[model samples]
Target chain A: MKLGIDAMSGDLGSAIVVEACRSFLSKNKTDELYVVGKKEELLALESYSQVTIIDAQEVLEMTENILAIRRKKESSMVKTMMLAKNDEVDAVLSCGNTGAYYASAMLFLKRLEGIEKSCLMAMLPTYNDRGVALLDVGANSENTAEQLKSFAIMGSVYAKNVRKVSNPKVALLNIGAEHHKGDEVHQETYKLLESMQEINFIGNIEGKEILDGDVDVVVTDGFTGNVALKTIEGVAKVLVKSLKDGFMSSTRTKVGAVMAKPALKQLMNKFDTKAAGGALMIGFVKPVIKAHGSSDAIAFENAMNLAFDMVSSNVVDKMKEGLK
Target chain B: MKLGIDAMSGDLGSAIVVEACRSFLSKNKTDELYVVGKKEELLALESYSQVTIIDAQEVLEMTENILAIRRKKESSMVKTMMLAKNDEVDAVLSCGNTGAYYASAMLFLKRLEGIEKSCLMAMLPTYNDRGVALLDVGANSENTAEQLKSFAIMGSVYAKNVRKVSNPKVALLNIGAEHHKGDEVHQETYKLLESMQEINFIGNIEGKEILDGDVDVVVTDGFTGNVALKTIEGVAKVLVKSLKDGFMSSTRTKVGAVMAKPALKQLMNKFDTKAAGGALMIGFVKPVIKAHGSSDAIAFENAMNLAFDMVSSNVVDKMKEGLK
Candidate 1:
């Protein structure tokens, strides 16, 4: 398998991407990587026979406008998408501005044949340890009932193939678990999902139940999904900060923190979003993974591994067949 | 101040409400409480001089239909709302079915004059401990831009008078921080909030920033607001559970848990939703506070105290002036 890695544009810069490429190639000798960035910055990966450095003249800034992807065709993010478009790589990975990468994917690889609107899907950690697939995290601000139905189909396919959940139980995220709970579009989408025979529709699931790990797939419009996803991240961050503050407040607690470091590390790993890897732009023709903006070397390498898994599992092809 | 308490419908039953009323009356000598419930269930409050037990034959189940409030007029929730409607009580508090309580408040107390829609406003704990007020948390499944504008005005009044934040800053909760993000109604609401001279309209706030304690009040449509609020609760619960599991995994960690218990307790208190009290049914003619259905004695008492504060601060009257 071959992967295209955008070596610039992440918050940590190209050094982490180069390190990630080095680590990933060391583990998977059969897989090849096309690392796109300034040639001088990625010199560290030059020794690896499986890695090819493609120099790009420009780098996309984190806050650059999405339309800049068109103007800066030589930028790492745009160039990596081009590699995927030309079939030089089976999958593409980036830790850049989400908007620019999403736009560039649409401009180059395009959507699957039956897909109307593409969505960003994230795997959120759940209590039971089997993560749940949540779709339309921030692809489109507003989605039609039919568009949500499409998300349900694609989410089911991704959960079944990538997450390996057989006969995935799909649900619509709403204010209440009742069918009549949300807005007009959601209420209409409920009927559409319930009538579908190809997927296991479990009616509605509330936001509070999303992390309970009861269902395999949860679907919503990009707006609400984005809010839910970020809210989870915010709460986790604040709590962890508070916990550290608590542990450091006094001599006794500081001692306790030292004693419990191993257990605490295990707990953090259980809830770490980085371990779950990047979000997948599911409706595209090839797998497109968006690593977190603040990804470290390990997180970025995990994203590449996710891209490889998507390619190996034939997720995009299965999603196309499911949509049909 | 005079307050009405619905004693029968909470998840913990009338015992906790009776205990809460006892604690409240003991602390507040001048205040009177009209506790509404079954006569047999609320006999424990008969000894207090400031407590009046109103006999209600029925209880609203947690899953009861919203329209049931009209039919079960003798239900404790409906009877409590009637106390506020008839001016027999300055404020009303309930830990019953949220839908039933909200509907009863609308049917009895009615919306304040000139208010287009009433919103449920929750006080979420923030890092700074000042907390942020999030509005329209499930009052209406959908809202017009005008309705969101009204929420901004009312939320500002709430923060200033009830929360005691002078010159409070209000923000619109959107998927992104950009002024042009979110659905069409939110885009129009952004312009409306920006033009409002009475409010300190801070452009847009994302879900991730809600708990950062940067803004005083955040407004959103009911559906999105509800999702965000519950998502916060869900993540916090899951993390705390995981932390407990981690601490209990080994004997060394168990010793650490004992040593860290005090500091951890302090941290938990800082983020406790109970300490912040209940969600207020804003835009009503009088303050109508809905305590958590799963509230304990302390949470129930806190809700009553919140109603007392709302009534004492004259939040409803000040909201009317702001809307005018």
Candidate 2:
């Protein structure tokens, strides 16, 4: 399979992309790999004969107006996704400005055969050593009840393919678990989800239920989902900071931190975004994994692993079936 | 000022209420203190001769059906709010079931003169010394854009009065800080909040900005508020559990836990709901504090303190002015 990668974007830039290419190509055979970005940035990963660079003069600098990054066709992220649409590459991976990548995904790659709009999905930190997929964490905000049901179908398929959860339970995130909970859209979505036969539609899940691991996928509009996702991130940051302060408050606590290093590392890794590899914008013609913006070589390699599995999972076909 | 406190409520119902009553009544003189609830429960706080037990025979059990509780007129929580509304008591404080207390408040204490709906007032966890007030965490999921604007006014007044923050910066919670960054109602609310000259309106505050202490009051409809509030709670639980597990995992860590007890205690207190007390329902005619469901005497005492200050500050008068 040929893979297209955006090498100029993200915190680590081309350095990690080169390493990720080296690691993946060394492990398996590929037809061809197209690396997109500025020539200088792409040249860093130019060692492999099978790998080729497509330089775009306009760079989507991370520090620049990231909102305006979508207009730059020369940007590595947009060009790479464009290549995937033209079938120059089988799949696309990006660690770029997420907004730019999302815009280009819609502009070039386009949504799947039946999906009205594609969803940006990330795995949630769950209680049962299992993962839950949360959609539109910062994507579409004002979705219709039908669109929310569609999200359930896409989320179910994505969780099965990526998380390896055979029969994923899907839930709508609402104010409460009761049938009459939430506003008009949510209440209407609740009815639709409850009646849907194709998905493993669980009843409404409260905000607290997201951590319970009771459902394999939690669905909500972008507004609520984005707030929930960031709030969780903010809370995690606060908790981590508090823990760090707790461990360094005095000499005894500092020594305790030394004793608890192993456990602390394990705990950190458990909640870390790295474990999920990267977020996938599914419901496209082919798999697309958006690596974290601050990705290093390890994170890039993990994203590559995710991209590989999506290629083999036939998730697109499953999505088509669910849509049917 | 007269306060009607539910004598039998909360995790340590009578003891904590009695202690808080003992502390509060000893310092502040009021017309009369009415203790409502079971006769036996009220008798526990009889040390203050000025404290009268108004035998409330109908007990609306905590954690029971809220609809049922609303029906019980003679229940302590309901009766207390009724007493406050009828000018029989100055204010009412309950450490009982939060949902039931809110139900009782809405039904009896009622919304402020012009406010559309009363909001659940909470001091969210923050790194700053002064906490930010978040409203409508669970009171009402369905709120109009006007209700949200009113919430901003109510939240701002409470933050200023109860916390004494001068010109508290009030912000509407949305996915992003941009002008058109939200769904329909949010966009409308943003427009109103931005244009309104009645308050110190900050632009949109994202979930992460909340704990950053940039704003003193964050206003949103109950759905998003509850989701954000619960997400923080869930993440905190995850971190605390992992911390405990980390400490007990090995002999070295157990020894370290002993050494780190003081700092760990500090960390625990920071995130502990039992120590943080209860959330107040803003926009009510009478001051009502809704303690966490699992509150201990310490948390209950904290809620009592909030009520004490609410009464002393004559915060209702301030909100009355804002609403009018």
Candidate 3:
């Protein structure tokens, strides 16, 4: 399978993306990579014989607005999106401005049939190795009932085909588990989701139960999902920092920290966002993965692996079948 | 100061409430307490000379509907609300059904003049000893612009007078920190908050910033606040559990666990919800504190101490003056 990488889009310099592509190509020697970036920088880097370089003049900054996507057609990110649009590659990946990346994909790749909006799905770590897929983390802040139901259908297909969860129990994220709880949009969406027979629709799940690993997929509008996702991120960050401070408060504690370093590091790594790769924008013609802007080479390579998995599973075709 | 406690409302039963009151009385002998509960059960427990038992024949379960507050007039929770309404006690405390408790307070205590709604303010653990007070966790799921503005005022006063933050920095909770982010209500509320001179109105704060200790008060509508608060709670719980399982993986790790027990325990306790005390229901004629349902005797004592502090600070009166 072939993949395209937006080397100039990440917060880290394009060198890291080139390094990641080189590493992935070394492992799967037959697979081809199109590294899209400025020509001079791409040529300056030590090249892999199997990897191809695609040149563009402009680079999209992280602070750029969504309008930049429309204006800067010669930008490297937009060029990468066009490659996927023309089926030049099986998938495309980026770590750029999220809004611009999303807007670029919507403009070039287009949405699938019967899908009103595409969603960003993140794999949230749970108790065991199995994690749950949470959708629309920040794709569309405002959504109607019909849009939400479409998200549920799209999320279920992704979970089943990509994550390999059978019958993928899909749940609506609500403040309360009761069917009548939440606002009018949620109440109406609950009824719509309940009527759908194509997916395994569980009732409403509360925010506290999101990490319990009971459900395979959780669906919500962009606002609540974004808040919930960031809340988890914030708490984990604070907790780890506080724990480190506590362990360094005294000499005995410092000694203990050395002994506990391996176990504690293992525990902390489980909550690391990079381990989950990037969020995938499903319901598109080709899989588009959004890696974290601050991701290192390892994370970018993980995103490439995720893109390969999506292509191999034929996830878009499965979603098209299910939506129909 | 005289305080009231719903002894029958907590999950630990009247015994823990009685013990907590005993502990509080032992610290402050002059203060009096009225323990509201079933007559027979109250008499069955060992009594203190300073404690007086108020007869209440009914008990409200956690699953009961909000209408149960009106139906069960003789319930222990409602009886405690009536005690505050009649000015028989300076403050009221309960660890009962949250919805029913909220409904009971709204029914009997009514809103303070100039206040449209009451909010639940929870003190979240941050990096340092200092914490931020987040409001409207589950009170008004749907709030008007005026109501959100009111919540900001009430939260600031509570932080300054009760939490002793001097001039507390109040922020509107949104998905993004930018000016034009979030939905319509948040956009309008941002403009309203910016115009208010009474509050130390910093602009918007995202969910990830809640525990960073940068802001003193974070305010949002109930829906977003509740989801964010619960998401924090869920993440903390899962992280601790996962760490424990990681520590027990091998014998070498078990030795490391023993050495790290002290520092790890101290770090975990920093995130404990009990250490922060119960959530306060503000914008009332009197302070109504809701302790966690599964609170131990120590947590209950902390809630009692919170009530004493609120009464001593004359929080309600100061809020009344600020609103006027």
Candidate 4:
């Protein structure tokens, strides 16, 4: 499998991306990598037989607008997608500007024949130990009933093909479980989802239900999905931090903390998004994996694991057939 | 202050509501209670001079539609709102159907003159130990930019008057902190809020910023707000449960658990929504507190504590004056 990495983006900069790719390539000798970034920076790195450096003149900063993809045609993120578009690489991965990466994928790879827009599908940890696949985490802020239906179909395919879930239970994200919940758009989307037979539509699910682990896939528009994802992350961070601080408060608590450290670490791992690797930019002609902006080398490697799986499983083709 | 209690509603019925009122009235000697429910079921309670029993013939179930408020005109929830509307009670509290309560309040309270809709404002726990107030948590699923502006104004006033955060930093909730984030509704809401002089608009805040305790009030449409609220609640529950289960795994851990119990309790208390009491149904003519549906008598009493504060501080009148 061949994977392209956008090294000039994200919070940690190019060095972490390079190190992560080098680490992955060293172990997975069979896979090849095309590291896309500035020529001077990338060429200075130690060479490996499986790695090829692709230099793009410009870099898309996190602060730049997504329109920078079109304006800066030679940007690393756009160039990486171009390689995937040309079939030079099976998939691409990024820890860069989320919006720019999304825009570049849409511009270069475009959507599949039947898909209107692509969704960012994230694997969220649930209490039941079965991860839930949530779509449109921040791809499109506003979505129509038709767009939502497309998200359901795409999410289901990703769950079944990539995540290896059979007959994935797909639920529309809403405030209430009622079919008539949310606005007119949601009501229509609920009806559309309920009528679908190919996908295992489980009616409506709320934010609380996302972590319950009952449903395999949860689908919603970008705005609500983004809000829900961030809220979960924020709360988890606060809880974990608070727990750690409380454990270190005094000597008595520190002893207790030592005894409880293993248990606490296990619990924290269950809710870790990085453990799921990265969110997939689904509905494109080719797969694009978006690692977290602050991802470490381990997280990037895990994301590459997901990318390799997506390539091997032929998720793009399966999605095309499913939507058809 | 005469507070109306919807006794014939919520997970636990009239008995819990009656007990909660009794508990609140016992210590809060200055406050009076109007318990609205079926005359037969409520007459069984030991009467106090400060408490009055108001008979209602019907009840609105959680599964029923919000329209049931008009259909079941004699229901406990509706009757309680009517009392507030007629100035028969200073405030109202319900641990019942959120939609039904919102409907009845809108019908009776009539949105405080210039207000287009009332909001459900929740106090969410943050890492800073000072919780942030989130508005429109499930009241208006789809909202206009104007309505969002009104929410910011009302939320700011509530934070200032009730929560006692002078010059509260109000923020528009969006996917990103950028000037142009989220959908068009949110983008327009940001500009409107920024232009408003009455509220201290802090620009756009992401979901993660909510629990950071940086912002005083976070405003969003009901759909996003509700999802975020439930997501936080779900994660908190899961984390607390996981921590408890971890503590019970072995003898060494059990001993540590005993030692850490007090510190853990303090950390959990920081995220406890019940201690902050219930969400205030703001932007109404009078305060309408919506306690959690599964709340016990203690939680309900805490909600009444919030109601008593809102009434005493003239939150509604201050909101009306501020908006005007």
Q: Write the per-residue lDDT of candidate 3 for residues B26-140, one digit (tens) a residue.
A: 8887888988998787774346777888999899888788899989999999999999999899999999888899888988897899998888889887877688999889887
Q: Where is model 1 more than 4 Å wrong at Cα?
A: A47-49
TM-score of 3: 0.95
Instruction: Report per-candidate TM-score of chain A alone.
Output: 0.95, 0.94, 0.94, 0.92
**Best candidate according to lDDT:** 1
Off by over 4 Å in 2: A42-44, A63-70, B29-31
lDDT per residue, candidate 2, B1-324, as tens digits? Answer: 677778665666566766667766666665467888777765656676678888887766676778876578777778777788798877777878778887777776667788878888788767654667888897887688999999998888887888888888999999888878888889999999888888999789888777766789999889999988888887777777877887788898788778778777887777665565678888877787777666665566677777778888999888999887
What is the iRMSD in Å for candidate 4? Answer: 1.1
Off by over 4 Å in 3: A29-31, A43-50, A70-72, B39-50, B63-67
Poorly placed runs, candidate 4 (over 4 Å): A7-29, A37-48, A55-76, B8-23, B26-28, B37-47, B55-75
Interface RMSD of each: 0.9, 1.4, 1.3, 1.1
Give the per-residue lDDT of model 1 (tens digit) for A180-295. Answer: 88999999999999899999999998888889999999999999999999999898888889889989999999998888887789888998887899888988899999998999
Q: Model 4 Cα displacement at B312 (Å)?
A: 2.2
Clashing pairs for model 3 are none
CA error at residue B258 for candidate 3, angstroms: 1.9
Q: Residue B115 error for model 1, in Å?
A: 1.6
Give me the displacement of residue A94 in model 1, in angstroms. 1.2
